[model samples]
Target: MKRSLPYLLLVVPYLLLPAVVQGQSKVRIACVGNSITFGHGLPNRTQNSYPGQLQKLLGDRYEVMNFGVSSKTVIRSVDNAYTTTSAYREALASKPDLVFIKLGTNDSRLPYRLKIDEFIPDYRQLIQSFKSLPTHPRIVLLLPVASFLTDTTRQTEQAISSLIIPRIRQVAFEEKCALIDLHALTIDHPDYFPDKLHPDSLGASVIARRLHEAVTSEEVKGFDFFAAIPQPASISSFYGYDCADFTLAGRACKVVKPRFAANGLPWIWRARFWGHEPQTDIALLDRGFHLVYCDVAELFGNAQAVAAWNTFYRFATKAGLAPKVALEGLSRGGVYSYNWAAENPEKVACIYADAPVLDLKSWPGGKGKGKGSPADWVIFKNDYGLISEEQALAFAGNPMDKVAEIVKGGYPMLHVVGDADDVVPVDENTAPFEQKVKALGGQIQVIHKPGIGHHPHSLPNPAPIVDFILKATKP
Candidate 1:
């Protein structure tokens, strides 16, 4: 392979192996590619590389080998012909039963991309090398991981999209090799490739899981990841991704999927306000968190609401969502988040409240300095079995009342409030709660919008909110 890139890294040999498990004849799987495949810039590369993760996912049934070199291109005449590397030779000598060839990232760069004319032929030749093996290995072509370099250098995304991917698809068709479109799998998740060219450990796990499904013959006739859930009532587009609306225990539930599920399939369960100011939900979807919602509205996050959420939680976790989940509370949704967290503290990953109504007395109850919803107020009273205004006013069962218990759950909290919001004033709702959490030495962050109101629930740039959730749910 040509070594023209200035920062070409040494191939980590431990993640993938040159040998199989002792005393067992496991299927020999060889992962062949460049630095991305070699686990460049990833911590504990030997254990977190795509191949390493694949080895663990496949368990003792297969021996995965990582024969990856940095800056290696499939084009033999290029500055770094992947075929010229020791990894290439060793990969061939390993006599693999299965091969995943993920080349072309390096070839997408400026000077190297000049040799684009040779990609198809060279890639075809590379495929033949493994096809000629005695084991007659099944070859799988991996399109390069998508990059967000935003420039012409460092494996240009435009080059990969325009020059490389089509060629890989063509060669896969001609060679009859399996194709696992890594580019499509990862394009929406630029965050996975922190450096824009190489994926971190979490991103590597996405590739590994996709490969696992292929090897294990796991087939999903219409849907894949959400197949474990009950059949959806319908599937439609929600913010450019698949939205499965299904009935779970007689309640309508929605799950807007990411382009690909992130590692562990972490998710954010929205309590209410399905799509209002949905910037944060959309962003989390791109980062591989499923945006879910269960309609338990009108119940005002009462015991019934919490019970419904408990049922949804059990079903969702059973269907493969992480046991602990991030909770999204928009306005009245705060009640659902806090009430549920109070009931099932161990299940909450974190809480994000936007212009939330932490205290019923402030909003629907109208017992303080904030505009109250008369119609919802009646509904709220009846929902909580409040005999009259007296009962509703004195009800200390609201989210604000449960701050101590919620903080004791050990999940951090994030609040986005509009300082001028009269619909749900921060002073009566979130402010006192924040003060209490701080007084109790609990974790809580508040982002106040100076003049903004409650209409817009999230920030224009949801990065800070997303970052907070990501940090809390880091696996």
Candidate 2:
């Protein structure tokens, strides 16, 4: 089954919030204002509302309340002044410990546009009212989400950005309150706002996730770092950065974010080994590069592997990774990397293969100088759907058969080989590939480790490899 649009990217899970919190018995969170907070266009309002989704992420330790009234405004003179609403009174009486105020899009309307001068005072009054509560809740002002409308129904993105958000920012600064820039978050995805006014469930989920990040990230280091995936993943320390283990498209996946993100969010997509010889990954991460892996074990760079990587690539790029990804393949990983790169050559920035199995016939097929694994050969034959050894030998789908396509991508290739590798000899793998690439006017570099087999994958000092990747990645 193929997924498209909203169904494709939405992997939200209705998870149970943790029951215990450190200081508070149950920290009350008040979600104040508008249709988005109330989840107007969502398929399931109760479950998919921003506040409802936020409750699931924050856990049972926090009580999230929704006091949102559709088409309400902070300006009292507007058509529906939020202060006059019963939800506002109820919110004031709820005694919240934290308040998130999101009320401005409605104010960007025609009738309300004239009375917008009163917005600041009303907004400040609203904040003071919340602060005056017995709990003295910490108020967080949210800039209005970008509106794609320009008609009389709703104001345009320009109106919201120039007329509304700047006022909200001023209110945040004047009141000494924290702020979440929802405009900046939603501006990129107009598709999230189908109606140009209300966000659907997927958009609501995005808001909730961003809220989760802003609200809890500072206090909790390991909180659901990649909630874009279905469930909360285990976030263990990876070189003092966050390495999340999760599943993408039913394949086990791992993503390690850089300590400090560099411009363009450049990333390296590693194949095969998740943790073996991680120097190159770590060095790249140190220089602000995201490291990712999607397990295509049985697929083995076949069409299915290409499809899985296609989804992964879309997911990564949508999440703000660079368009072109660096490929890292170690030993058999070479098969996964090169085969996929061959299929989608333009998607690759560069290829770094270490003692890779360029031709499976050389290793698993054991039809060459290297000692072959009969079991793996059987598995490979089955995966490729080859009926016989003759058919397998006749297979023309290997990376060795993809030199023209890979070189046509116009990206450089780097190979690290052990000259004495008997498992997948350098001559049978990287050497031949390099020769083909060079003959065809392509850039290919090979670093040979003499008297070394395929035991160690990368250099102890990964400077050369790191330098090569950084240079390739640079604009």
Candidate 3:
């Protein structure tokens, strides 16, 4: 009976082990950084930290641990170095499957900024330390949120923009680690950051959502675009493609071509939103379309910008790309896209403008029903050689002025605009523009996203936008 009892005990334990082990199998994620990750000012640190929010979003499958230390710098030479902390050691020992490092905010401080040169090496070392762990975690480097402080000499936006971020990007590239751009994510939403540094509960949620998207999507951060076009002297590889960075008539010009051209060589002329909200372009690239842009920023689609586009167009066409291309403009990009299409109607296939400033007067000039950029207004005036504010106010050469030319060309147009857009109000831009186009027998489709603003440029699923471009540019 004693021998039977021992066998029974062993068999019972073995029979129950599989279920317990299966239940325990959760992907461990270590959130390693400073106060931001620590949920410093949040009312409830346990539930409102980005790591905490991330766990909720990821459900029961992910065990996210906040290994954050307050005011710690990634730069090892700095006084409060993150590497010296217990959290650092624990993070390494945890055998985490994934690690999110958000440590550059403290490094942006003026005291730490002096040791800027040490940033890259130290960051690389940190990434390597995680990579060397037995767990072999996938490390993601997060660019810190923009400092809203106007002060330049201290830990301000200038320090972040000039010193920390560029180096961080370079380190991410050098280490071949994925990067999640928190800077771009929260730059517009200053309201989210009550302290202008540490995000509140709402801001933490935003960070968690973006992190979830970046992590779960398994997107190769800074992917190399395959280049099938002739490499220009100024061109380099950007996210896995051949990219040309040169000045067209002394203005910044960029061209990104895919590794394989779609049938008939379809391409998109990105009037604006070059770096911001690139999902549409990413989708188009997947469908075999080349993405190209010329920085007509502050030009407001003036004659100079048109000339630059003409030069770019000739260069692009001569390089064996399709003659007619789709135009993608977001916000101010609408002016460049529509103005260029109006001037050279024969070269355009379709136009997709999102919350676009079709009328410059509605935006920079502050002439109409929108809050305008006084600084950009000066640039807009200078670009057109306007001698006075009165001249700018009376200027008749806006995109709306060229509606006849655009409509005459039989080009299809799509506008994904916010009904609540006050910056480039639909009443001043798309509403009037659509009415004119339709009255003149032009084909235009408007997708009005309710309760949205100019901030979010594209739909969650860019399929409809991509479908429009594909159908318009079809051979």
Candidate 4:
């Protein structure tokens, strides 16, 4: 038998060559792109490129290689006619189980012929080169990450990704390869990317996880055609109505009106503070920061909430309060406080939600009710033209979502909730939020009083919440 084995050895290479030559990634992946995929700005090679992160997500099950080149152009290779003529040969050399191509960022700036005309044929040739290999790996063309603003350059890039990348996908589909649309995963997630263009390690991790799930999961839907569109500004700006008074019409508000008019757009004011047991006299009188309160529709006094909030802003301005402000509210007032604070984070110095109802989606009675009161779901639908309960819920954005946004931008929050309060449960209110702030590498002060119930102002000492503000807001 030993003597016979020597004769078989000669033919073994020929048999094994087919398997080796055919790209069956027992478990390997190849990531190829520009600096965006290469983890530019990351201090170490072992740090957070999407490829490095993808390998970690796959554990030992898959091997991922990074073949990204900074300032490299796919057009340079394609117009010249080979996928890897000495130029990108280094990237082509790392044969992989799966290949991810993230191109077209730099390609958008080149001559139109290079991006639209030459790119497809060049990409087709590249695909052919890979298919010619004994081990033909699966290929995935990741759409280029979206840019910050839709300027001329970014518009060009977006157009390239929107138009040319589809051709790449068609080639992948014809070849039976995988396709991952990172453009969708990152559509509304701006905080993930540090600069508008490149993914921070955190952003890279998000892309990697999305990619991993796309490859491994049975139900990986490509980017949604109708996902939520961000408002194109910070949630904080919405809360503050930031410069709405000035920017929209390009002039300062000259006089206070019964109905707020911005650029002559008829608008009503709603204040969330006022009608508290002890009264927010101290807050109303503060000359340091202007406070914009959003009054509940009517419970805290219908249009009166808006009236009171405006009065305060007017009074504060009269009293020499700084343009930057802070918000404070209790129980129902919490809704107004959170909303206003979130909308105007830059102007909002801080926020104090004293036993406030943060989420209307899941609130008292696990339902909403009351006229002019924001708690009612049916009313929201009727009032806001919302078609469904989910739409209604989404209609009113969640300020809690912006807590990290606020903290990251240096606006602190102080929350005081009763642990035993059923009206606004601790677990549902500020407790979970406490964890979020900690996770985001931000700081928020939350004071939990054990055995306490519903009303935060009813606490024996409301002074602590006040004290936190004084300390936080002080120059």
Candidate 5:
């Protein structure tokens, strides 16, 4: 979907926190705030909330919690019982290593008027509640997003800015917590908030990116080393099958010799990721190295057939190819790259997995044992040696199970997937694998294209990946 506002590119400022000071560590973070943190009116709810996005950027190392209530705030008011001290107490009990607090929006709009002195003290008490915790979690005060609608709401927001923000900053300084001036940033870029108050997906994405930059800038240092790979020369072939089988051409033999041969390459060849067959496109081939395209799922029913293709990296290595052979698998093809890379760490050099089916347990086969196509079920049963579907799933095709093994091996990988793809969900395909790769200290490069589909071959194209492979496969 095209964005209505240019809010995606906005950068959030740096935040000073203990997590940043401490560098990298497995810290538990909790988002305790009101409706804004609850992700009101957002299509994805908490899945794409600020905390959720932080989880993606932070990977699996940190445990992030979203303890936001729909109609809650810190101020005490009889009409708005939802926003009260009890909410604050519950948040304190969660005992997070890091806490992000976003309030004041609802508090600013509360029906009951309160003296500035009373409001300031109440806010101070809330900060103290978390500071009093035995664990003494690091805190970040998220300034409430600015309201950008009519003059009335803007006036109300400005009122809060005048009355609450100074105090919040003072409290943050006194309590020794990190203060993120989101209020000023959002005001500067009104386009970031689509509904004029709450953030749209793009707006949320911007906030998350800013938060990530802040944390990673201070906490993350130099990255692990990875060997460079080369790019494919040109488009040799794509995923579609030749139409000769179904056309009149099937019966008509060419009067002259066919211009291109499927076996034109000197090396043994099978699958194609882009362009047409018969011509040598460096984009598809790594010179001096055998390029094995294994599609076990049958290319989602295409003749270039591959299933769990991404996980089939070991097959190429086991076939006596050089240790520098690069792998490419899209959708179920990802199944091949991930699985093969996991098992044959020593042999395979790099991977180009696009929209891969990293987890078979959830795919081809749904959570239930009998959810996939008849062929898919049969393949799983036969390959893994199981009688029942559940047993087969329980026994085989779990990419996650082999993550540690791959991480220990430390192979270079490039993962490309679409953010909006409903077919091969990012969580099932690339997200978990990316997390595992990062955790095992392996090198993985991820490219996420927004508003794209599940076809990785098309979105990221084959050139860059081929390039990555060529450079990475050096002998």
Candidate 6:
């Protein structure tokens, strides 16, 4: 049927429009912050800033604008207040669907620290200002990265820890805004910050990856970990078995390819002890399960440590390994295993923890019956930004606190503990944890060795462990 020219033109254009144009709309994201957002000190400021990287990561469906001014502060009373900046006005004018606030690093400066009392109210006001906008953006508060500067007077990590972050947390809670813990993300990674303040290119990439994960509710997978391994790296040989020594996210990593690849290339993610317990790894290698490890020693499975593991997981999975991994933790490695598993429940197949330090309070904090390491305790507290023993006691992010999530994910856990262990006693660490898991209706198997201390992690034969792993990770 012939139609009128004007009507036919309109109808044809509408019908011929691309599916994308007719479907979901683009998300407008306004990245509002200071020098960090401004991409200062970054070589390729236009392309390598967190916002710029976020745009690439988000692809065509998102418009991530970098509206950041150098030396800007959330506090209006500060010498260079973000409220007075043109970037602030531009951010408001952009009418973004999402706004990420990464201020307060500059506010922690000595001059602005004096007016720190005004921070909460000022931050609240700023948040309200965004809320009042017609767009009513979904605001996310980013806790600032830790300062690496030795001069405590000018820009102190203590100021951010003691004054800024607590207030930021309160603001997010009160305002019902999402919070991304950048502080924890960058805490143990001092190498990320080249100038002791600004993040280098790699550091910015990490931040962008984290932000993308938060927004999309998806993990950044398929990183080529082996590609990042430096040239001329030495392969460690154990009894004619060769393992490639590589680096993932600047951390030491080892990959032992299986004799035969499983259907999905199912691998065992050794949380720690790359070479300590050869029996289990060798057995797994014989069974076509690739053995992998990324060193995260002394981190105690804090947010930073978990983040590193998350990166490693992505890299390994992308490198043709299985999407789900069987976690093996021996002694203190238990902390890394359970914590990483808890954070990423769906990615884990099962867990095997031997003589594990399930709770930091037992082996590290010394809050319980076990004899703790004083030096390690200090490091633990500092890694997590724990100011007092009371805070450490009250902290609930431990593996013990994550039983519900683990159960919900349907991940069965196995623990090997020593009954007479004093360093990390079963009575203090594994016993109570197992009880809680069972009480919560979670699947947990415990193998207790009597008259054994914390030493001699993993099984001598490893046949039983291998059997369990095979069953758990069966394709």
lDDT of each: 0.80, 0.78, 0.78, 0.52, 0.54, 0.77
Q: What's each prediction's TM-score?
A: 0.57, 0.54, 0.58, 0.39, 0.40, 0.52
Candidate maximizing TM-score? 3
TM-score of 6: 0.52
Q: After superposition, how far is residue 434 of candidate 5 from its true place, in Å?
A: 45
Stretches of candidate 4 off by over 4 Å are: 1-26, 77-87, 112-115, 149-151, 154-157, 218-475
Question: How many clashes (backbone atoms < 3 Å, residues ≥3 apart in a chain or on different chains) does model 6 have?
Answer: 0
**How many clashing residue pairs appear in each of the predictions shown?**
7, 1, 8, 24, 48, 0
User: Using alpha carbons, what is the TM-score of model 1?
Assistant: 0.57
| TM-score ranking, high to low | 3, 1, 2, 6, 5, 4
What are the per-residue Cα lDDT tens digits for candidate 1 across 156-190? Answer: 78888888877876686566565565665676788
Residue-wise C-alpha lDDT for candidate 6, range 33-120, written one tens digit per residue: 9999989999889899999999999898788999989988999986799999888999998877778999998888878888988998
User: Residue-wise lDDT of candidate 4 within 103-173, one digit each (tens)?
Assistant: 76666653543356666666666666666764565555676666665555443446655665566555544
Q: What lDDT score goes with residue 417 in model 5?
A: 79
Considering lDDT, where higher is better, how would the candidates rank from best to worst?
Answer: 1, 2, 3, 6, 5, 4
Model 2 lDDT at residue 453: 93
Error of 5 at 316 (Å): 60
The true-versus-predicted C-alpha distance at residue 318 of model 3, in Å, is: 17
Query: Would you list the clashing residue pairs of candidate 3?
Result: 223-239, 224-239, 224-240, 225-239, 225-240, 225-241, 226-240, 226-259
**lDDT at position 265, candidate 1:** 59
Find the 10 residues in a row with the least total lDDT in model 5.
253-262
- For all predictions, the C-alpha RMSD in Å is 12.1, 19.8, 13.8, 22.7, 21.8, 20.6
RMSD over all Cα atoms, model 2: 19.8
Clashing pairs in 1: 1-80, 1-81, 1-84, 1-85, 2-79, 2-80, 2-81
Tens digits of lDDT, candidate 3, 407-438: 98898999999998878888999999999999
